[model samples]
Target: MSQFSFLQSEFAPVYEHALKAESAALSDPRAACFYARLALETAVKWMYERDRALKSPYDTALSALIHEPSFRNVVGNALVTKARIIKDHGNRAVHDTRPVAQQAAVTALRELFHFSYWLVRTYAKGAKPEAGLQFSADALPKTAQVEATTLARLQALAKSFEEKTKAHEQAEAARLQTEQARAQLEAEIKLLQDEIAAVKKANQAAPDTHNYNEEQTRDAFIDLLLHEAGWPLDQARDREYPVRGMPNNAGEGFVDYVLWGDDGKPLALVEAKRTKRDARVGQQQAKLYADCLEKEFGRRPVIFYSNGYEHWIWDDAGYPPRGVQGFLKKDELMLLHQRRTGRKSLSATDVDSTIVERFYQTRAIRRIGEAFENDNQRKALLVMATGSGKTRTVIALIDQLMRANWVKRALFLADRVALVNQAAGAFKTHLPHVAPVNLITDRQAEGRVYVSTYPTMVGLIDDVQNGVRRFGPGHFDLIVIDEAHRSVYRKYRAIFEYFDSFLVGLTATPKDEVDRDTYSLFDLERGVPTDSYELDEAVTDGFLVPPKAVSVPLKFQREGIKYDDLSDDEKEAWDALEWSDDGQIPDRVDASAVNKWLFNADTVDKVL
Candidate 1:
């Protein structure tokens, strides 16, 4: 019932302070004040390190603590005698009628180790002994009864702490196991990257020079990704995951599957392409999706374009190599041929003007859609490539939710203005039947799919939680954070934890090697789903176009351009870039060193 209990966990600082007090009373004043400080420091040192809680009796060094005046008064003579027994030996050796030899100090140090052991056996892990110098429970006299009660209470506390220790150990073990699994996954991914590099090394394949329509290729590539790296298909080929549209204009648009995890929210408009043909064309189609989609709920929709053969992933945020990608080295790699295929490159006109679609379902899309529609409390992050009809797939989801009446209201968020503007336009164009649509922003808050920027949400959370002047609770029933990769921060996390919004996030690139903060958010928010079929289904079904990788025998075509929008740390990286003997990157470049580098038009302007 105490205020402090509600405010914070009490165990951390209490034990530390008590141990400090105990040490100060035990150190001998005979040595310099330095020795006293040393004793106190040593006693408390175990606090910084792990002290095994042994069940056996600690007979020696513990003597100092138990025999001290304060300890004797608190405990009893029996405990004091145990401590004194060992102290007596050291005393004899040091105080004997002979010069104190090197052996005396060595012997004292040995006794100190025993004291350290006792420290671990006792206070270190809260290990309780059967009996110790304690207040006797016997109601024989005033002092005895008081002593007994004190010991009884201490015994109970010790017992409670032991249980807590066991729980702590189990939690730690689970965490370590999770970490190990992650490490193993990273290693496997690295191996796969090496394999891809080896394959690309065989021949330098040039970029596709094609004059083609969008649909066939997008479907082809999606199939490729699914076939190569997605999961198996169900016997029914999975029934339709219905897309429902809410009447509230705020809740417009139909959607397919939405995958939720601790990672944030992702909405997927999934569709599996049959992996029957070459996957090259599919990739191009998926890439085009980026041009059409808009931002939603301050995040971007990730396009997972995979057929049963190859996977071509894209994100509304313009990030590539999304799901499972590895850097393939080119020296031994087959360089992408610089051949000029008579085929012409794609023009903007060739790309689909409509990024967000209403309804399109393949077995893969249906399965994912079903998952989302059926999922009760999970928040999802949907990934697909640019040209792939992620919008269309998500539309089905919206329609399904409305039809089910599961959603009272929904919020659509996105990563950027141009991107979300596409999402907003989609609602206006397709779901016009739904009335009273609202758009949420720093300045405006209306709409079922509340679209805004990640920074805006983070800022709003700060306003709500800290003593900021603005903010009301329960902003939305379902919060969809678009461009989730860019929106993770302390404030964003605070809002999610502080409110009860059914959140769903979407992105093309689910994982990024850079900006670990995004992954950290994923771990904290979504405890990695047990059923994940990204790599397999895409490969088996021909949705995403498989790569015809041509690793150029070059380091890189200049580490592309660093985007103007960057976090604080990224800006620091930008400010420090150095070139090698030719155009390759160097290891380090400080501010002063960067200024020294001469720039010429012939040289690449940006650093990796």
Candidate 2:
């Protein structure tokens, strides 16, 4: 006989279906729940037949069967409660359109199993019921108790999922509402643009001229360029932007207008002129304002200056300031900001490698150039041992930066006149196309490439500090320091601080005790150069000869010797030397006496 034979022929269908439900529980819990529901209904019907007085209508719900007094009195409230729970879950399984939750189904099935076990024991002819039986967890097997707890935990998870889904739907609705509001704002802006265009057309057609003042011109530009260009003129931009830079004769300065980005930082600046005045009238003021804003924003922004009629855009990274028909679209301005800030690093392909002579030199140029591009670093340090060709490597890097359009004009500084001349020679020979001006004699700071002695640069910085402001902060796109370990320290540091250019320091010994300050000046980590060719590596690569240490012990005493130890001939010579009145050796002492007193012929021969 089967192990479930206690579920007799009348209850066989309930037992068979319960077995199928158990088989499907893991892989297909929905099917298992449906089958479990069927088993519960069958068990309830079997109980109903046993007590004919507890007659349930043919269409009676599973809850009614459990609540019937005849059935309840026989099975007890505990068993009836389990039967009711199964009835509710089973109805959901068959009638609800939503798929049954695994936990819900598993929980209902667990309760049904316990109820079926009780029914089989109570109703089967050969079965025996334990006295005072109850459907409490303490009476269940360990595995069944554990599974019941797991089902409860899963039910909690399902509830959490439902809550999260509801939150997501609410967030999505809010997003759509925001988009609709944005669309309405855009439409209003479009209407404002049309009104401005109509006004401009009407003004041109009218015989009476409209002489708009500076403020009126400013307002017109705000409506025509900013509003029409989709900038929205919201909290992000500011008029009469307060900035402090190169002081005037009165020692006060501020920008006229500044454009701000969403990040609450300055993006660009506009220097407005009266409708009748030339836009170039404000260029010098705009340049000073740009320098001042760099302190607050950490990057110099795109520059624009305009009278009411003409607009001009300037990018220090690319070509000179030129007239544009109108302001660029807002998206184009953002892209220009990204490019100006060097958000992406340059690749090897971006560099012009033709001037680089060797593989290692090329590698150094690529790495340091990429580092500069990556961070838009203001200062970079490169250490190559003497004879390792630092000048050539730096030239290659500068060439690459210029070719990539990262640098427009460059300045090279050195401590001595000879070093400056040497650097100029190298630049002329290697980069023949680049005009290398001598800043010392020529008094010229303007050139694609300018070689200058540190003292000459000092004079220029003094002029700027005294308010003559000979060179603007953006005068040089890049500055290279040769023998940087010496030139960038002490009183010479002002030259570096005055310009807002990218600084590159080249040294033969960066990690030496005296050069540590130089390393720190370039912002290099301790003992690390941005690009390094160590003495040992240079020798290993055969760029330099390996130095050998040879020790030769000297027999002669370094300290002064007593006159008593001198030989007879030396003593005679020393005695013959004439003394002054104060007992000092006479300035008229003969060469023969001096040489003989210092060393005998035999001693001189031995040293030689």
Candidate 3:
């Protein structure tokens, strides 16, 4: 009688988890949310295994799996959004200790039901399930016993399954009977793939009748986002809150959501619109709500508006509304409120001398500060040549910004792992109080400054846990790009666009040598960067030593070496070496091939 009963046949594996999720809805809400996500993940992994069209991603993390291009193409936008909601809520249920509501569990089950319906309709090999089948809450188990399991245990179980799969494959390779079993499994997978393709082709010819319930999905997603940011939403007054002094004839309107401070005054107000509508449509409406709250409490609250997919935060008295990936945490919002009156001038702040005592480095930091505070520029590029203390200069700049209360958190991105480690060490040594975290080694470590390679940061950019992203748009107050060049701009420009943070690009290459696109990324002219210190200047000022070139003359390098000219021991050694796979050796070696194809210890030592 379970709404997920249809999964018992072909999707038996998923059925067990889905049934548990459905049964636990009224009893253990957290387990219900977690199991629902597990069921969806199982089904999706099943599809990837059997369906030829769905290619696997390099990283098999659930977030990466669902967001993979091929997977998205197969599921479409509606199912993708559903998967996101289930995954997000499930993440929250496991990661957060706060009690999850029964309604959240119910919403997860409903979304899972629709997702299961799609899977069976598209992939079921035997006679397809009835199109008329509908999910009913009444069909869910009224009372049922559930197991107590932790997220760690579930993850270990998943890992065990993977190990077993590998072991089974190895056994199949060794024994003929097991090999035959694997062959049969492969054949079944092929048949299922064909069936999936046929079903999709047939579905294309028919009228679409599936109901996505986008409006409800949108509201659920927004709620999960708020929940992730530490909003309990337990009280009846949290949503559709009543307020006075609207511009309407009634002189009042219900605010969509109001986040309250401990004193009962409003911390912030959110105005939510339908998913399809522009989030900006609620901007003026949110302003009105803020005005009403300020009148009532004698304190102006920060305003936010969203359509589930897009979110914006505006401290109207100080700054314009800007799009954000998610809502800020309570402490972050409180800090924002405090900063309205307490923030000091960034341009007036003195650069830390202990971090960077060089004259050019300090000047570069001052120029960047002016670009940010005076010019109101969001991005700045520093073109300092190699060995010119680019890393230390930025470290000093971050110290200044942090002291002036302009930045709370910062991210330093490097293109190479070695560079990430190197920069992290510099930051730790100079700004020890900030506590830098190297994401390359330990991603879960928490700190004020985060350091990562470009690829590592790209993988982490979309990571959401308990309905909140690990690296939201507003997560970092500043993002520093190391070795900013053409490759970074071409391959990882999305990282810059995704985080709504002040940016600083550091490069050893001069402006003229650097790519035009890299300059454009920092909103600078092709030959004019925010600041520059050429290698020639550094050398002239005695900050860096000029390179010295020396030429060494070697007999073998200048002329070719003939086999007959070698001494007895040298000839024996040459004959012993393998010149090619066929064991053939040339009669003579060319001058260009002295170091390229031939190596002599005595000659190399002499040259050195």
Candidate 4:
């Protein structure tokens, strides 16, 4: 291979000139010296560009470049001195118009070869450089393959860049179109604000007038907003429809207006009241009718209340009522329903039954999974004793949940690192084919199942709070907090609220303070367990060994002294033997007094 092949693309020109200088040394010393100077200039320029700190725009002197700290650090004094000698000799050949001696040219070529070798070793990384480089014409690259290969690579890069630029231009065009649409929407909002301001000004000027006809005002407001929202209000609405489940207090309470979808079923209920009443005044009545309508129909309709001048909308899906300028279109209401209900709809029957499960574990999974179906609850606690195979049971639960598609990702948290690692190991043992992610050292918790210590989660929470890392509240579908009693506390409470996922807390010590806090977190009543596999039941079922307590008594201190048993003088002496605040007798107590008044030394020694 050619010596130039060892150098990188950036140093290719220097390599080429050095090789040429070596070749021309004997036949033409002046030409050889000129090429050597070109080679040094190219090398210095490469070094300057590699470290931008070395670039001196004001000074272009070659001597100044050789003296630079960056250059000297890399090349060292020996190489720098040799470079100077070569530069001086090359300058004489070029400026003086004089021919250099064969010896001088050969020496310059040798030094240039050494510099090339050093550059290649430092920067080329993998290529091998010739150690015994000499002034030989035969060593120069004579083939055209290198030039052809470089040209082809450059052409490919240009094509790649052109494609990227076209894609960028398309994205820019789409962004501009979106910006224009936003600007138009902003203009419309401004117009609405101006109209509301004018009405407020008129109302303030004539507060006691109240001369507007309520029916006409209601019809006018509804008509204007419906037209703006692209709804045919006249055809889309049914007037005076009797609610199916509502009490007939006023001859079958009639709904003001029920908006229908394309399928001729109710999509929303709009309770229109007189302009004198507030919009919120109709909220309760609207909610009552919505419940009645939902019972009659399979799905609940969007609840809306309007007092002609203002309108508000409410959905039973936990979102509170909010005032809007206009009603939601039929299509918009359907989209909202889909988003709220279709988010996490997984059936228990979808679980894979091929995997084995303990009887207690199966029961726990059934109960907890059913509870997940309840819309009112989002958290639960599994109270299983320490040796009752909680980790194995949770792994089985996770497996079923994964199969049923209830949880796409889950976080397994523990207070201690060892417990977290143990849990991770249990998962690997049960699902040997699946790999678990370790969040403690990985900087990120990835994969379907993530295992982490509570401290690591705190760090992640800190990062998210400071805006250094961005993890959405709903990133994880489920969070299983192991030893939940210890993990959920005042200092780390934010970790629970930051995630909008279903929580399952597992703990052995779920009583007293822990039990109260756990219940409060899950919003459960006293003495109600979300899922319980108690120690007694586990022992009875042959799942754990029965625990036994042993008591031991000391012979010497079998019967300790009592204050009531002492004589009046002994009691006085004992009381006078003053002790510390902690109720420990002072060391200053007389030994003879202790032997005579207090217990014997043997008893005292045994107690100590």
TM-score of each prediction = 0.29, 0.40, 0.76, 0.38
Write model 1 residue lDDT over 55-95, tens digit each, in one string.
21221123323323445442233223323322332233222
Which 10 consecutive residues of model 1 have the lowest summed lDDT? 331-340
Q: Candidate 4, residues 15-107: lDDT per residue as tens digits?
A: 787766666666666667767877887788666654433545323446557655567765654466557556655554554323346666766
lDDT, residue 503, model 1 = 52
The top-ranked prediction according to lDDT is 3
RMSD of 2: 38.9
Full-model lDDT for every candidate: 0.36, 0.63, 0.83, 0.64
By TM-score, the better pick of 3 and 4 is 3
Which regions of candidate 4 deviate over 4 angstroms?
A: 1-347, 350-356, 432-434, 464-468, 510-514, 550-608
Model 4 TM-score, 2 decimals:
0.38
Worst 10 residues of 2 by lDDT: 137-146
lDDT string, candidate 2, 1-608, tens digits: 22233454547789787765665555455556666777887778655644434556322446446655667776654565566556555444444445455655555556665676666554444443332332232322222222322344434544574487579768866865777776886676567555544543453352422211234424444333543344445452366666655677754566656777767777788888766677788777787888888887887878888875556777766546765434544445565676564633457445445666677787787777666756645577777887888888888887877776667678999888998889899999898788888887787445689898876776554232211133544457688988765435754665675565678888777355436677677877777777777788878877789879998843233433446667899778776766556667432344455556668878888886
TM-score of 1: 0.29
Residue 227 displacement (Å), model 2: 30
State residue 596's C-alpha deviation in candidate 2, in Å: 22
Say which candidate scores most in TM-score.
3
Model 3 over residues 1-608: C-alpha lDDT tens digits?
A: 68887789989989999998988887777789888988998998888877788887655667768877788798876688789889877776776545677788888998899899888777765655566676666666667556555566655655676697679767867764576777887888889888878866775565547665777877887787787677878889889999899999999899898888888888899999987788899999899999998999989988999887678988887666777767777777777787777778976788888889899999998998888777777789999989999999999999998888888999999988999999989988999999999998999999999999988998887565654567766688899999887877776776887787889999888678888898888888889999999889999999899889998888988887999999999999889888999888988899988766456777677776
TM-score, structure 2 vs. true:
0.40
lDDT of 4 at 129: 47
**Total residue pair clashes for candidate 4:** 0
Ranking by lDDT: 3, 4, 2, 1
